[model samples]
Target: MLDIFKAIILGIIEGITEFLPISSTGHLYLADYFIKLNQPKSFINMFMVVIQLGAILSVILIYFNKLNPFAPSKSHQEKEATWQLWLKVIIAVLPSVIIGLPLNDWLDKNMTTWQVIAATLIIYGILFIILENYYKKRTPSLTKLNKLSYRIAFFIGCFQVLSLIPGTSRSGATIMGAMLLGTSRFVSTEFSFFLAIPTMLGASVLKLGKYFMIGNAFVGNQLAVLLVGMIVSFLVAYISIKFLLRYVRSHDFKAFGWYRIILGILVIIIGSIFA
Candidate 1:
C-alpha cells in the first residue's frame, strides 16, 4: 500500500510535467530521490515511461474535440484542413521513428548513467536560453493547419527527433525548433501538443512490447499499477494543458527556460553528491 501511494505521486508528476517543456524525466528524477526510487524493481525501472502513456491518453481525451478528426467535414475545405493537419503530424513523427529506433539501444545502455544525463541536461538547457531570445512569429490563430507549409512541417518533425536524447525534452526541442523556423510560439506549442498524441502513444506501445519480451512474471500487478497511473496522469495532464495554453497566450517561455537552466544545474549538483 505504501508502494501504491508512491506510485500515485509519480503518476501525478508525470501527468503535470510531461507536456510542459519543463522535463518530466527531470521531475521524475527528483521525485525518485525524494521517494528513494533509486533502488528499483524491474517494473519500477520502466514504471516512469509506462506512466507516461497515461499522460498521452490525456492528450487524446482532452483534445478529442479536434484530435478525433473522424467525422466528415461539412465542406471541401474542412476535409482538406483535416488531412493537412494529419499530414503535418505524420511528417513530424516520421523522423523520430527513423532516428529513435536505432538510438534506443544506445540510449538504454547509457540512460541510468549520471554522465549521460548530466551532459544532455546541461547542453540542452543552454540551448534553451539562447533559443528563447529569438523573435516570436505572430502567426494568426485563424491560419488553419492547411495553410502550414510543408517545409515547416518537415522541419518540425526533424526538430522533434533531436529529443531522442533523454532530458532534451520533446516539447522543448520541437517548440523551440518551430519558433526558430518562424512559427509563432502559440502555434508551435499547439502543434506540439497535437503532435504529441501519436508520437507518445507509439513510443508507449513500443515500450509495452519490450516489457513483455523481457518476461517479467509479475506482469499482472505491473499492469494494474500502470492503469492506476494512467488514470491519474490523464486527469492531471488535462488540467496542465489548459493552464499552459492560457498562460502562454499572455506570457513568454522565459520563465520556463530559466527554470530548465536552474533545474539542470541542480540535477548535476545533486546527482554528484547523491547519485
Candidate 2:
C-alpha cells in the first residue's frame, strides 16, 4: 500500500512537470532523493522512463485529429498539411538521435545530481526571462506551424540537445529555441508538443529495451506499480496539456521561468542544510 502511494505521488509529479517548461526528470530525481522509494535501483530506473509512455499517450489522444494524416474527415489539403507537419517533426528529432544516443549512459551516470539540476534550472530560467524581454520589443515573424521552415525545425532540434542534461526541460528548450528562431508562443508551444511525441516515445523504447536486455525482470507488485504510475500520469498529463495550450494563448512563459529559478534555489538551499 505504501509503495502504491509512492507510485501515485511520483505519477502526479511526472504528469504535472512533464509538459510544462519544468523538468520532469529533475523533479522525479528530487522526489527519489527525498522520498526514497523501497524499490530496487533497476526497477526505479525503468519506472521513471516507462511511465513517460503515459504522458506520451496523452499527447497523442489530445492531438489525434491534428496529427492524423489519414483522418477520413480531412480534405486532401488538410491531410497533406498533416503529413508535412509530421515531416517537420521528424527533421527536428534527428539531432537528438544523433547526439543523445551516444551520451545517454554517461549522462545518466554522471549528471543526475541535485547540483547539476539546480544549475540548469536557474540558468535556463534566467535565459527565459531575458529572451522574453528581448522578444517584447520585436514581433515574432513566424506565427503558424505551416510557416515553420524545416531549417528552423532542425535548429530547434539542435536546441533539444541541450535538454540531454537532467534539469533542462525538453519542451522548455525546444519552445525557447523556436521563439528565438522567431516563432510565436503558440506555435513554439505547439511544436514542442509535437516534438515530444517522437522524442519521448524513442526514449521510452530505449529504456525498456535496456531494462529487459540487462536481465531485469519485474518482481512481485512491480508491474502493478508501473501500471498505476502510468495511468495516473496519463490522466493528469491530459489535464496539464489542455491547461498549457490555453495558458500559452494569453500568457508568456515568464511565470514558469520564475518558478524554475525559485525552485532551483530552494533545492540548493535544502540540499545544503540536509547534507
Candidate 3:
C-alpha cells in the first residue's frame, strides 16, 4: 500500500536524525513537501512521535556493551553513582513533560507551520555555530557520565523543551547546553543518546495512548505500516548512530549546521515560489 511506503520513508528519516541533533521533526516536516501520505493529521503527527521508539531502541541496542553503563561500579561509593545518572536523566526529562506536553495544544495549533520551522532552523543554526565556538574554549574530556552534574542536566533538559518546536533539535539543544556547561563533545553526544531513550520512549507511549483512546488504532493495514516503519527505522537508525559517532570524533557539527542552513533556505524559497 502507498501508506506503507510513506511510513517506511518517514521511519527512515526518524531513525537517521532522531539522535543526531539535526531535528527529526524538522526533517519530517520538510519530507512532507515531497512524499505525500493521506494519513490524517491525528495519525501523521502521532506517528512521528511513535516511530521514534524505533530509534530510541537503537540506542539501547548499541550501548548495551558498556560495563557499568547506567550503573556505577558495585562499590558503595559508586553505588549511588549509577542511580544518580538515572536521576539526572529523569530530572532533565521533567522540564519537557512540564513544558512540552502541557503546551501541546498551543504548539500544534501554531508552531507546526513551515514558517515556524524555517524560523527555528535559522535561529538554532546560529546558536549551534555559537555553541561550537564555545566548545573550542571549554574542552573538558570528562568521559564518564557520572561526571555530569544534576544542574547541568536540568539545564540541558530546559534546552530540550525548546525542541518541542519542530525545527529545534532536542539532541542539538541538549548537546549545546551540555557543551556550554562544560561537557566534552563525546560526553555530550553520549548524554544526548542516553537522554533520548527516556524522552523518546515517553513520547511514543503518549502517542500510542492517545491513538488508542481515539479508536483510530491500527488495524491490519495500519499495523503493517507500523511494523514496516519500525523495522526500517531500527535498521537505518543503527547505521546512522554508528556513522554519526564516528563522524563527530573527526569533525565538528558545523557540517550539520550548513545542512540546516541550506534546508531552511530551501523552505523559504519553495514557499515563495509556490505561494
TM-score of each: 0.89, 0.97, 0.90
| Strongest candidate by TM-score | 2
Q: Name the top lDDT candidate.
A: 2
* RMSD to native, candidate 1: 2.6
User: How big is the positional error of residue 73 in model 1, measured in Å on the Cα after superposition?
Assistant: 6.7
- Backbone clash pairs for candidate 3 read none
- State how far residue 187 of model 3 sits from its true place (Å): 0.5
lDDT of residue 188 for candidate 2: 95
- The alpha-carbon RMSD values of the candidates against the true structure, listed in the order shown, are 2.6, 1.0, 2.5
Relative to the true structure, candidate 3 reaches a TM of 0.90
Candidate 1 vs candidate 2, lDDT winner: 2
Query: Which regions of candidate 3 are displaced past 4 Å?
Result: 65-80, 273-275
Counted clashes in each candidate structure: 0, 0, 0
Residue 170 lDDT in candidate 2 = 96
Clashing pairs in 1: none
lDDT, each prediction: 0.76, 0.91, 0.79
- Least accurate 10 contiguous residues by lDDT in model 2: 266-275
Candidate 2 ranges beyond 4 A from true positions: none
Per-residue alpha-carbon lDDT of model 2 for 59-83, expressed as tens digits?
A: 9999999999999999999999999
Better of 1 and 3 by TM-score: 3
